[model samples]
Target chain A: MSIERLFIANRGEIAVRIIRAAKELGITTIQAYSEGDADMLAVKLADESVCIGPAKATESYLNINGVVAAAIEKSADAVHPGYGFLSESPEFARAIEQAGIKFVGPSADTIERMGDKVAARQAAEAAGVPVVPGSKGRIESVDEAVEVAAKVGYPVMVKAAAGGGGKGIRIAENEDELRTLAPQAQQEAAAAFGDGGLYVERSVKSPRHIEVQIVGDGKKAVHFYERECSLQRRRQKVWEEAGADCLDDQTRENLCMAAVALAESVNYRGAGTLEYLYEESTNEFFFIEMNTRIQVEHPVTEMITGFDLVQEMIRVCGGESLSVSQDQVKKSGHAIEVRLNAEDPFMQFLPWPGKVERLKIPEGEGIRFDHFMYEGYQIPPFYDSLIGKLIVHGKDRTDAISKMATALESLEINGLKTTVPLHKALAKDPGVASGDFHTQWLEPWLEAGNLTPENT
Target chain B: MAQVLSPLPGTFYMKPSPEAALYKNPGDPVAVGDTIGLIEVMKTFIEVKAEFAGTFSAYLAVDGVPVTAGQALAELVV
Candidate 1:
């Protein structure tokens, strides 16, 4: 059934994006927010708004019951969970399903199955996809872990079975390190996800973080190419680009086909992403994990393909078939995106929340700024430091690099520190311009005191 | 003497809600695991539980103000 009223179970820029997409489809938008987000742009733009609870995420955004209540109370026919918060929560999706409300995402079963990293690994193996060889499933005891480690060899990664978004993972170079780090990783997983299940995987050295975007209708699915997400800091993406300048045509096609194969194997519905780690030395890629939600850097893919993915997800959820097939999807030019965070990059990326006294957004061809910030926008000190995204498109990687650097220079956000300076340095870096950086490249570079203005 | 530490960063709350009674007050008897206040961040509320049995002496953090991790929310005297 088509959505009549759509409730956005999230805040920030993604909320605004979903509202626009739903409104474009002639559906009324309902916004759910915390007390601190009452005055945010999403609440202001929605057809109706509700303050689910206080500013604390648990009482509001992360509270499945509260979000469901808001959707039901608003008479929303469907709920769109944006990224982060409870977006990946299978329990939340199940609650929405049990409430007899449509979720603009995969089924609760799909989320539950894919959310567990170990289960997803097993599923990938069943689908004939290449996964980093490790424990057969979640390892329970230290002896079991050691046994698996002996088989998998050293330099293994201990991961939270249910973890994603780049946290709750640790790498051990030797058996001793694994024995010492496994329990610590388990405790962290227990505290973060309330699940202490741990698994081991062979660690790929300096791998390129490549992710393929997939959309499907349960029985079939298509790929939207892939994004080069290797340039990261703290295992969190700082820069993203559509298509890897490093991959050959054959390799690119194979990677996208591999992603589509996995999605089709699961009979996946809605939009999902399969992340892979490509070993540069071997030119072989192994499945990392899948993110069962829309991503922050989706703009780069959108730019390259000219597809409004948020709209696509909404329409597909409303029983519409994907407008295009795998053959119909086309990519053009190159696109790059950088996160503009309200943080002091020089000071260990410390959050610098404050009101923007002045803002000068760059405006030019191939430049897109995705943000909800305006001058005097009081970035509440209580949430993620990401304030906006700067996405740029060009004929090729080099053009995109220059255009992004120009865009960063033109963007002048005053009254608070930001990672704009860092982005500028990254854009001008010879390695980044040549697309030579890897997943673990940016952090040590930052610690090496490479963020100075002259460094650019 | 003892202190109640905020487990996470957020605005401190003395009571469960404005209409609800305060969790603890000065001169109130408290036990280990007693919730002296609430600390909320990222839309999550975590209880600031007492570590040792004591008489609650004072609220170190102002009510409804931002408190960071390990910030003392309250003081206690044995």
Candidate 2:
């Protein structure tokens, strides 16, 4: 099947990234955007663009019917949802398929199966993959949740079974907290995911978040090693690195194989991530969840493996086989990515949307900035605060850290406050540099070391 | 004083109970914590309360219309 024109059903740097990849493949690109994003870099960079809907994301980006209409109107052969928004939405995937355009990710059924955390956990368990002890199914009542918690033991996590993003999740140390927190969590989950279904799981305190990147063509799968995304705040990832330095050979191989096994078990296609929680003391890893689309931190994997993952994804969608086998793929130097959001880390990380007054970017060997900012681009408040990602790759962790520090120094955006200073401090921290970090690393580092700019 | 506003984002409904009469109407007296309506977003219903004592003016958002963060739901005559 020839992909004449591809419609990107998302925005930001990811849209631009997909457009560039399509251009390289000699395919015409059609960019879709809401009202506020018409002049975005992706729209300007693509061959053509269409206003999908109003500035409100629900009426626009997440408007499944509108996106399908845009794809149909543009005569696009395939629609690429570049992470977030409707990237993992099975309904959107089905709508694209119904509109006679190929959805550039996993099959719709696979998305549905992997979307619910409970079903996904069951699938992993059935496949012989170790999953954290939790509720066997969705808990419909607070009483049910309490019962499940007692069975699972204390210090359990209450998660919105239908949603993610750290929302609707509460860790209760005892039944009293569980009883109060459970209803609140359920309400929040219902508000966030449109499904109030809750589930219980064993909480892995001080565990490192490691995930393996895998690609499949429906018949076979290959692993691209793993990424360490231990640095996070409020359950959102901030800093990510590829080829975690702390892993020994045995553990690394085990994690990689486990990821591949899980992918094969489900007949997963395209790009997917199998997240795991690694306990340093026991060296045990348990499957957490499977993200059916390309992740926000895909660049780290690309840098370490020298692979254009987006291009590979498009090819896979176009009915091509996996390009590189397990043996052929290589993990090179250390790579790190720090998200540059238009928010002040000190001021509770509130979104600061404004025009870029003076933009000075970091430039040097092994440093790449993936952003859509210019001298006068207005950062819209309607969407996520992530303006760009600053990625640096080097021969080792030390080199990568030093290079990232230099890059952060060279970076300047005068109009809006950013987390650049926060990243800079994190890069220079002894614990971070040595890779002795956990999922709780970033928040405490900011609090204890006074990395917030105001503290200075 | 002017009424503050609803704290959460959702679909605004004027009546508390579907079978009961509306809570407040134009020129009706309201105080802080008085239930103005119900806002349902993603199946979660949150009561929209009057932030201050005032006379009800008009509903800014239509019934069952989805609202977002900080979008006005109603107005009041201080």
Candidate 3:
């Protein structure tokens, strides 16, 4: 059931990514855009374009009714949410299905179940995936949280049952802080998500954030190995690479198998990621949460596995089964991805959205700039600040790092500040060059005044 | 005539909610920090506060229209 026309219900780099994938499948593309983004790269590249609403994401991208109406009016057979905005929203998926259009993602029920961090944790544990030890279930009150904290030891993380993107999170070091923070966290969760339920989990100190990429055909699943997303600033990823060199072969296989097992347990369909917090000191990894969409760092995995994940997702949604078996999946070379955001890292990473007066994208073999920026294109102050993703591949990690360093040095943009300066500093930093940094390393390094122009 | 321009890129709203009445209208008097409208973006609705006090003139942009930063939102007669 290959769709005749695919409606892209997102914007920016992901929109461009989906359009390229759909065009390869001979499917006509209809790109949905806000008034401010009518001239976006995807809109210009798609077979057709539709103005969904005003510039605001809520009125355009996040408006389920608006998106569904566009799909129906344009006779689009399938809708691709890409990532972010409404990609993980169960209600949005249901709206698309109710309109008799394919959602190009998992079923609504699956999205809902996996969306709740607590429920996803329960699901992973039930599937025999190793999870960090903490409260047996949702804690009822501060007393219960204190009791759980006592058993789990100090330094427990209080998380909202329905949280995402690191919201409703608190780290309590001892009984006093737990008693003080549990109720405060509950109130905040109640205000934010309308769910006062809370859970406690043991915090992995200086953990390296890694995730396994899995794609399923609604029956079976296969993993494309893992990506190390440990270089983070303010708990957000800046640098990512596939097939990390830290883990032993045994550990890597075990981790990947655990991810696939979780995918099977959920009967997941389409592309998803199983995130983990790996503590290299103890050689142990704990399941954190599952992202129910193609992630931003997916290109690194694609470079290693030689699979077009977006295309694979579309094919699976079109009723095509898994085309390759586990044995057929191969990992080769090394790949690294750096997120280039239009923000001033020196000004606390504040958004610096404006026009790109000059743009000179890097060019070389194994260098890919998955971006949507062009000369004179206005970078709206609304929406995500990510201007592009710079991905590079090489024969080995050192080769990849050297290539990436060179690529970062050669990259140029004007009229707006970006994280390029910070990345340039990071590429030459000894810790990052040697891959010795942990998830919490970047912030302290920045706090040490390492990102100043003079520092670089 | 001084124009109250939108300070950011978003949808300009005359009402707090669709069913709510317009926050201000032509011929209405306004003051500094008075919320003349709301600009919606990224799911956050920020109040388009008046930076100058004056007699409220007609709105330059239609309600619910997308407006770029520095684009005139409403006209003010000082």
Name the best candidate (by DockQ). 3
Best-performing candidate as measured by lDDT: 3
lDDT of 3 by residue, A1-456 (tens): 778899999999999999999999899999999987878899999999999998767788889889899999999999998999999999999998888899888989999999998799899999889889987777768898888888877789999987776767999989999888888899988889999889998878789998999999888899999999998876779999998888899999999999999999988889999999998877889999999998899999999999999999999887789887899999999999999998788877766777899998899999999999889998876687898999999999999988998998889898888989887888788888788978888888888888878744
Docking quality class, candidate 3: acceptable
Task: List lDDT for all candidates, in order.
Answer: 0.86, 0.85, 0.89
lDDT of 1 by residue, A1-456 (tens): 677889999888889888888888889999999987878888889999998998777788899988998888988899999899988899999999999998888999999999897789888878877888788778777778788989977788899988885557999989899889888888888888898888897888888999999998777899999999988887779999998888889888988998888888888878999999898776778898998889999999999999999988887887888888888899999999999888788766766766788999999888998887778787776778788899999999999999998888889899888999888898888888767778888888888888896865
Model 3, residue A300: distance off in Å is: 0.7
Sliding window of 10 residues with minimal summed lDDT for model 2 chain A: A447-456
- As for DockQ, the candidate ahead, 1 or 3, is 3
Which structure among the candidates has the greatest TM-score?
A: 3
Query: What does the lDDT read for residue A274 in candidate 1?
Result: 92
Q: Which residue pairs of candidate 1 clash? A: A56-B43, A56-B44, A57-B42, A57-B43, A57-B44, A58-B43, A58-B44
| Candidate 2 or 1, higher lDDT | 1
lDDT of prediction 3? 0.89
Determine the backbone clash count of candidate 2: 0
TM-score, model 2, chain B versus true chain B: 0.81
Write the candidate numbers in order of decreasing TM-score.
3, 1, 2
Clashing pairs in 2: none
Per-residue lDDT tens digits for candidate 2, residues A1-456, read: 857799999999999899988999999999999986877899889999999997668899999999999899999999999999999999999988777788889899999998998789888888777888888879899999889888877888999989678999899999999999999999999999899999898777789999999998888889999999999998889999998887898999988988888788888888999999998876778898999999889999999999989988888888888888999889889999999988777766655666799999888888888988888987766677798999999998898988898899889998888888888778777888778889977777767756855432
